[model samples]
Target: MRDADPDLFVAVAHACLLGESPFWHPRERALYWCDIPGHRLQRFEPAGGALAHWDFDTDVASCAPQLDGRLLLAMRDGLWRFDPASGERRLAAKPPYDPAKERFNDGKCDPQGRFWVGTIYEPRDAAAATLHCLTREGLKRKAGGVTVANGLAWSPDGATMYWTDTKAHTIYAFDFEPHAGELSRQRVFAQFAPRAEGQPLDDYGGRPDGAAVDTEGCYWVAMFEGQRVLRLSPAGEVLREVLLPVRCATMPCFGGDDLKTLYITTAREKRPAAELAAQALAGCVLGLRVDVPGLPVNVVHV
Candidate 1:
């Protein structure tokens, strides 16, 4: 028998381009995310219907809640500690240059209190990027070659890690020794077709953008150009499929009072006017109610 149809949960308007990196702040009862192309960070509180945004001078790739209640941000310049309350920013790391061709992309904090960030090549370049782990001790360890590094999440027990390279249409898993910041036995955990199985992909090279893990150890991944977020078991079996009004869904995170609401972000990058008009919600924030709640947001060990 086929699964039941997924429903439209929330149709948020006025989202910026390349919406990504959804993080939940439980204390504030808010959901935070970024728009890469618009260089902005946004927060939404479903409880009060409050929406606030911050525009940065550079692309904000991802963000995590710091132990002290501020935010640790991964921007185009590298890593920074941002005080959303006071509007102050402190640089944590500087990107190595090839000025016109390289920039920071997606990242997330692991359970071990370290941040793993990756870079991406400009549209015209073919050079691969790398993922690096940053520790509170001020040491950065190169985890080696990655291209178009995008989604990131850790398993429920902190014993496995997942990361993606959008250009590759592949999600990889590692035997994660979280307490030590070590990875082993990299293998394919999931993959996507160039299209939504039967439909033509709205963008080139259908791949994953961002992903999240639930308390049940299942994964929810956003499919850029595929117009859906796919939930899969740890063995990589599809559990559910959520259709989005927009094709370029970038990421998903769990938020709300019980962390059972799934919040998603999308992108409008590289689309023409006609496509943009057809997909007005393309870069908007989307939400849905699910039976499963997500794991707690990992705190940055400062």
Candidate 2:
């Protein structure tokens, strides 16, 4: 059953082609997100409902806040630091894979300040993607053999890491060592039935896209094509299911002065015309108030 809440509403007016990787800046009290297909980075200040965006020549897949107020962005070409005040970007690392066939997708900073990012293998024929960890030491491939790497998050205690492969309809968890940013004993955390070729939309539980963890250690994940977000318990049990008004919910992050607002980003790129017509707000950012506050945004140290 859907948890109907009056607090849910569209937080941004503009629609994006593919909105992903929403990060709530704690100090700025603002929300930052990426429109990958649109090649833009967006910011929203709820205090005045002001919206700002920066256009990029390449796809900006994900970003994380840095201690120096700059943004660490994972783009099609490489890892970069973007200065919003001056509109300048400095390359930190180049693409580890063939930029033509693979690009960075979902990413976030671990508790120890390392930026962990995963790739999307565009071929869609094989598991050719990999996840990498970036630190001052350099980029290291942490895991591999995946197609669409999404749903990256950590447990509240930072002892477990969660990651998902959207095309496979699987979420994986790993025992984590925060200090070294190491993942071990990776196992299936959750799995959904594959969306059949002629499957009805209402009959399918969407594949995992992007995710976040709350203070209670529950994992909240957006379901692409499922039109909902699922809050899962630590043991992989469903706690709450939030039915969204749109079809392609891409990701969810917690924001607000108290970190109780669940902000979700959706997608419209490549969707059928009939589907888009049915869901007018398919690509807009949506929000709702929640009782549990979320874990604080992890600032990237480097």
How many collisions per candidate?
0, 0
Error at 46, model 2, angstroms: 0.7
TM-score of every candidate: 0.92, 0.98
Candidate 2 lDDT? 0.93
Instruction: List, residue by residue over 156-220, the lDDT tens digit for candidate 1.
Output: 99999898878778898999986778889999998876555455454443578889999999999
Residues 29-104, model 2: lDDT tens digits: 8999999989999999999989999999999999999989999999999999999999999998999999999999
lDDT of each: 0.81, 0.93
Give the total clashing residue pairs for model 2. Answer: 0
RMSD per model, one decimal: 3.0, 1.4
Stretches of candidate 2 off by over 4 Å are 1-7
Which stretches of candidate 1 lie above 4 Å from their native place? 1-6, 97-99, 123-127, 195-199, 202-205
Q: Which candidate's lDDT is highest?
A: 2
